[model samples]
Target: MASKQQTVASFVETAPPGELSNVVADIKALAPSEAQALAPAYKKYNEEQYITVKLPDGNGTAILSPYNSLDNNRYFDTATETSFEVDHASQKTSNPQPHALETPHADLLRNLHKALTTTSSEHFPTSSHTITPTNTDPSTLTILLVATKFSPQNFWNARWRSTYTYNPSTTTLAGSVKVDVHYYEDGNVRMNTRKEFASREVSGGAEAVGREIAKLENKFQEDLNRGFGVLGEGCFKSLRRQLPVTRQRMEWEKFQGYRLGQDIGGGRAK
Candidate 1:
């Protein structure tokens, strides 16, 4: 009769006959030749330990690790290897896929957070500006409606920005909070908001972050509607002011592309 295989956890708890060495040997076998060079230890997850391995030929790099949820002798890591292909964008380039799902609004949100928390308001006082808060804390997030402007003379441009701290309950929130409200004027203006968390440990992790952002987006929409209405009125005022009048040809002035005054027939003006 054949002897039954022992599990890693069981082997750890009880020193079985030559089984410890066998487990190490098993890891060595399953791990790649590159991992062998580094001498990988038996890991709990995926039956393989984390190892950093590189190609002998060139500057190519990769980190490969096997992961498993539970300890089972049947499901040990087998033949762990790193591919030559790597995305420089991914710090964990050895992993098959990117770690964090970076949404499209990442850049915009990052800039907003940066400007609101650290910089002072007086830096750029015109066209675009950042509003400085008198009281700032790691916890206690607050948003102030600083200033939003639509150009009275030229309504083609419009913008708004504000500062806020993202956390209220210090006990519940870990990591410093940063929040910024940003408005950019394109041809058509519709407000959109997004949020992302950094690697630092948070109180509730992603779940907490999701809840906070949902609240922020809703708040953003409410204010956005109000701002839109006011800015729209400004745009209409400017447009009406700039509307062409019927009786206004007294002198030789720039009008259309042609010389359309009393003496000047329809011809290109110099």
Candidate 2:
């Protein structure tokens, strides 16, 4: 047996089983009591302070502690938000920014003229002139000009009429043109011209008129494009027939009325 007690090695000595188990149990047991004692103290300390109460959605409100008993909460609503700030001294309030001027009737008229002159395959036959508003009110502007003439005969046989409606509310512009043509046996033509009555109400009020004018002006260009396309097709059809180009020339001439010449042969040549 002595010989069999060969060398046995142990890395370290171990305490008897359960020797310090009671001490470990005591430490574990003290942790809960310590935590409980600290809980009340923490509650008491925080009771006198202001705190931010957070909601599940992450929005929070300031709240006074129970011990402090002060009205620390402040809430803001849309109507009472920063945008509603008022200057008491100046008796003024803030409002959202307004939109910039986007459309103008003058611009639209120019575009329509350009489209009619170029796309209709006619030299700048149409002329436009501006009529200033007699009143100081900028909203009361008027434009007067003779429409294009389609035939040379329009010089002798033409009658002209103009009608329009102006609305200060919506800044809208609309109107129509009607032309009558008469041809003589001697290769001459005449035009009787009339404009349809139209009007628009500017929806955004007086302050918005300028902007609406701008919008209408842009739309005017689009309308001119469409109008010219149709007019071009019709003119092309007539040209194909090789009929007396009298009526067409007369209508073009009507547009040149007042602008081109004082009398038939006395006017400036195109």
Candidate 3:
């Protein structure tokens, strides 16, 4: 049998450079508690991290870790090789919901605008999102939001896109990912970044191309979650009105509200 050093050396030889510890952990099949021991020594490993470049020419590459979500849980379009991690407001939803900034709309919109610009970052580590507004031109302001997902254990990162027009109360978001492995794409995913571009196409069936699409979707979800937090609590609450509650339901809702307050803070009893 190979010595421990030789075994680790073999793993180091096959795995990506600078990830010897990660490979060794996999080979050793350490228990969860045991794995915890190695965490501190290899905190910065990039074995699970990914960097996808949106090429200006419409062909891009996604090289990184395997995604955790699969078809059963998330959304994907294999024909176009694109995936969606959070379809929270998906155009495909059966009962599509519309969310907006809360009352005192101006203040909310201003806050959201600030949040989008300040917290959101661009695809590459070095770049960032851009906002364009025209007061003299008499056009609505344009805000671009970039969302990302990064998993340290897996060492992966992903990027997704969304846009909002506050005046119109409109939001449009789509997800994306990159691939360097062999797979057939029915078409490329057209996108606009520092420049407009698309994905490169390849051909392969579900079994062969499934994982790539899944991982890409995983990254898209991760990146997408990074956004929407800057607007503060209850920022995206939907609007609804209370109906005439036939006297009985009215009393109940009122009592329920009081009870809720009590539960929250003992009805603010001093």
Candidate 4:
């Protein structure tokens, strides 16, 4: 009779002899090529003590570690992987069967990705732009944007990130777009808003829908740029200052002098 197996609390914990033996057996069962493919992941997990295992399918990527709650007691990662494919427009053809209504939104995503990434503006260069299709009923798409000042000397390190979720309009129904924005400088601020567009806006074709959505995104980004500047100069300036009114670092040793005569020695010196 075979000995019973043991389970560790999480992947971070060392596998017991029984579990280790079983893992070894699983590895051995794979074909030679497949076993060879596992070498890199094994080495990475062994050395770094953590690893994110990307699914072979393009749908998403997974993190296999204790941090992920789904894998707390199992060797396999059960948590859903939510990922966006950067510039997914070019790879859209890979989908065997796409919904009839997705084409216009695909165009919108592609246009947004192109316009943002191809700009030469030094103010905020495009860092990343990605799109993920949310296959829920009344299909929708999510677009993520990241723009940053790419200079090493720029201490402020200004960054603008936004997420836009688009709901396509049917023949009789108007559609809506929801946007969430995060702008970072000395401090960060966030804004969320939604807008509805008439069905006529997207009625022309894919190109029309793409153009309309791109226009809305550009306007929203510009508004946030102005808003963030105002906030940094007015409200956030004091919080970011390095020195007090003396224009120098506080002298902790001298601070005790003020407390020499008070209870807890916090008053002026006698």
Candidate 5:
């Protein structure tokens, strides 16, 4: 069995673009030999997540989660379980039906912008005054709006519920554990930060607003894990030290209506 530390080191060493291809080639080279026993496990692990360097020559890198087999069932299965049906009579019914398509967060932000700008009875005149989306450039403004929606404050306020229904036996190691442990140990925090920055820039800065939410979420997860491990030892004490600065950045972004300079202590967000 591979040591967790060794697995993490291997991932980190191969995570970079110029190096990752070489690493994959090495893995391929190993398939007929030492790593043959683990080939099935490796194939499944590769399917879960992979790194993509957008501009391999430049600094651009992205962690891609392309079309996993696991994600499709989540959306489709719910409708089947509910037994909801739509017929011609119901389609022609004169009552207003809520939008059937499940909207993505990005789409919701766009709708929020449209609602803020367009005049209607549902939207208050004062609300329009509070948010001026017209004068601002749509590309830049949309990003800013999205960022505000997902700010750390808003994310924490939203109701959150999650449960892990399946747990592997403690006695034996499993393939799933290998994949998860690989990610947790080998994933690049800096790459994640860059991806967050680029995504915000692409989405009209909404991607940037996600960083704060990400920070809070990371802290929350850390605290939860620590709470489970040792009594009275909150994991966020060192992490919280940086919150004041992030709060300042959030405020600056809110008021100035632009992204702050990306010098968050050498881009570590700590």
Candidate 6:
């Protein structure tokens, strides 16, 4: 009997020209249908809890049952929040519907979110603000600004997304800034930075944390004002001109001496 690999090799060797290619094309054609069928199964498995158990009366037989399902119930809803303990530290995360931000920490995030929106709107008129992961402590506040110029007629798009978080318990302020410039000619420039600032006061109380928040707000506002200028300069000039080498504008003046009418082979132009 031929081995599996040898059998495949023999089939490939004996097939007419393009038969192997046709087989590969057919497989590629089925990928979309396979992916479509798999996507829902993946989502369902992720959202539902199940356990596989062996049957006592049969060999290689098993059944998947909903975890902790009631015998009288046909369907069960899984818990929204997951919790685990690791080395005395308990961590919990929730997957629930969006809710309002009402905690004191959320109040601080809301204030920062408002300020960031005000700051970014100055440079980018088309900007959006959102507070993400409303369930997490010290929720992330993000502002995204997008700008596109039609000088090249839909040849490029640029965007800047900035995220900030303040933790009152730790007296720390964190910022993540990202800039992306994508060109239609298969070119891109990306810049990202993450930094944290701590309070300088010896007392790590509410007043100290408040001061840190005020200072961070001011500092970030100034950075936004200056950073937009720097990004504009960097993105449109530095890397944008260098990538997709075919898009560069040639310096005709520098090559004037090598042109047909110019001096060549020790002979001057007439």
Best-matching candidate per lDDT = 4
The local lDDT score (0 to 100) that residue 119 gets in candidate 1 is 32
Q: Compared to the true structure, candidate 3 yields what TM-score?
A: 0.19
Q: What are the per-residue Cα lDDT tens digits for candidate 1 across 1-270?
A: 322222333333232211335444554466434233321123331122112333333344222222211122111111122233322112122223222312233333344344433332432243221111113341233222222333424423222333233342341322222222323344433333433333222355324543443355456557667876887888656665442354535343544544454335433544
What is candidate 1's CA lDDT for residue 243?
28
Q: Write the residue-wise lDDT of candidate 2 on 1-270 in tens digits.
A: 422111110100111111123322443365533332332232322222112222223332222133112122212111111112222112222332222222244343343334333322332244322222223344544332223333433323221222223333355645443334445555544433443445666554333433443354445446656865886788756676453323333344465554444344455767
Model 3, 1-270: lDDT tens per residue? 985544444444444322344566675574444433433222222212222223222343221112212332232221123343322211121211222322334343354434433343223343223223322221333333333444434444334443322232332222233322111134322222222223323133222222333344455546544543433234434322344433223455455556544443445544
TM for every model, in the order presented, reads 0.24, 0.24, 0.19, 0.34, 0.22, 0.36
Residues 145-247, model 5: lDDT tens digits: 1110112222121112111111111211111101111112333322211111212111223232233333433565565566546643456344443545555
Q: Best candidate per TM-score, number?
A: 6
Ranking by lDDT: 4, 6, 3, 2, 1, 5
lDDT (C-alpha, whole model) for all candidates: 0.32, 0.33, 0.33, 0.40, 0.27, 0.37
List ranges where model 2 is wrong by over 4 Å: 1-124, 134-139, 150-165, 174-180, 186-195, 201-270
| Candidate 6, superposed: residue stretches over 4 Å from native | 1-31, 34-98, 132-152, 169-171, 186-270
Error of 2 at 255 (Å): 44
**Distance (Å) between predicted and true CA of 124, model 3?**
18
Candidate 1: segments with Cα more than 4 A from true spot: 1-209, 235-241, 247-270
Q: How far is candidate 2 from the true structure (C-alpha RMSD, Å)?
A: 39.2
lDDT of 5 at 256: 57
Cα error of candidate 3 at position 250, Å: 67
> Candidate 2, 231: how far from true, in Å?
18
Greater-lDDT candidate between 3 and 4: 4
- Local error of candidate 4 at residue 179 (angstroms): 7.7
lDDT of 4 by residue, 1-270 (tens): 421121111221232211323444554464333443443334333222222333435554333322221111222222232321211111111212222323345565455445444442333443444444543432655444444342323322233444445555552223444444444456544455555545443455434544555666567668768987998898878676476444656566777654536533345666
Error of 4 at 68 (Å): 22
Q: Which has the higher lDDT value, candidate number 1 or candidate number 3?
A: 3
- Candidate 2, residue 249: how far the Cα is off, in Å: 29
